[model samples]
Target: MSALLVQPLVGGHTGAAPAHTGLAAGHPGFLSPSGVEIVFVLVGLVTLGAALVTVTTRQLVHAALWLVVALGGIAVEYLLLTAEFIAWVQVLIYVGSVVVLILFGLMLTRAPIGRSPDADSGNRWIALVVSLAAAATLVTVVVDAFRATWIDLEERTGPGQGSSEVTGTALFRHWVLPFEALSVLLLAALVGAIVLSKRNSDAGSGSGSRPGSTDSVPARRNKAGES
Candidate 1:
């Protein structure tokens, strides 16, 4: 009777040990990434490439198209992170509305669709230095902030928690001020773009006229009379 109980207890302990070991093995670590992480990294690379092309390309239309790709890649990243609502919103607002608005603005302003010599300001080296500094600062801040933090993703094995309702609630409840501020910023951007385009158009129209605009018409009329 004693031997039977001992044998069963040993078997139970042995079985439980493997269960714990399997769980620890399943947990993801920094060096061991899951499929989702791999996809996320790949999409991030593509997004970065698209963003670089958008900024570096000489053709305005091609840059806008690459901007679309970058924005779409960000949406894909949100989807991969299980924020489906945010992903869809990103697609609808940024990819659909904002990109279309940009294209329309480009067309209405008569911006060059092909390569334009005025695209770059000949400050590539300065811009690169500034960009590298900014990137380094951001990376340092983020790493320092998150280095001590650890998220137990194993506890979240159930369905996603980023439904539209939940996200909307969270946005309105906690981030309402920022949300309104962003809307104001976007409005400001639109107004600024319109103002700049109008100024450019006025400047372009004035460029074709004589310097002494008030006297040129009179001078032309006198010449015609003399002729």
Candidate 2:
């Protein structure tokens, strides 16, 4: 019994080795020749799918989650193309920070967890047309710009590439202002979200209270008295 089990296991391993070796040897030639183009197509498809879901999904949280996936795919593409710095930044900013903030905003705003017809806008057709036109314009511009350049796909960088260092230097030296501006923008967005939420809560509470209730009356009187 022992010999039978051991023989089968050894034979299975032996049979798998050649297949694995063949796949490994062939994969680089196949991938290296056309990997970048394949990845680009895949990235575009993923991004489009995610964007469609984001717009069409009735649940706000689902949209945000789809956005996370889209952003992550972009990061992966960056990494695949040897842009390590951009990839890490994408993960740090979009996946780590922005998505979390969006989720927080969704939770704080008391958005519906389930699908709702109210979430769908009536002007979806107009939006779709505009989006298609913009996409076509971008594609046209890109094709016009790079139509003559031949893409060499097999020349991928190894682990020793200086992408991170150069990116850091560029960010600090030339793009410092833009980086700072982004921080300011994020801060402003946070403040705006907080203010809007607070205003909504206040309005809700105020509406729930009787108009001439003593608490409101005294507050109004105090304001007038102070003025």
Best by lDDT: 1
Clashes of 2: 0
lDDT for position 39 in model 1: 94
Model 1 misplacement above 4 A:
1-26, 144-159, 171-227
Q: TM-score of every model?
A: 0.63, 0.62
Q: Model 2, 2-24: lDDT tens per residue? A: 67966665455445444333333
RMSD of each: 12.2, 15.8
TM-score, model 1 to reference: 0.63
* Candidate 1 Cα deviation (angstroms), residue 72: 0.7
| Top candidate when judged by TM-score against the true structure | 1
Instruction: For candidate 2, give the lDDT of residue 169.
Output: 78
**Per-model CA lDDT versus the true structure:** 0.78, 0.74
- Candidate 2 lowest-lDDT run of ten: 22-31
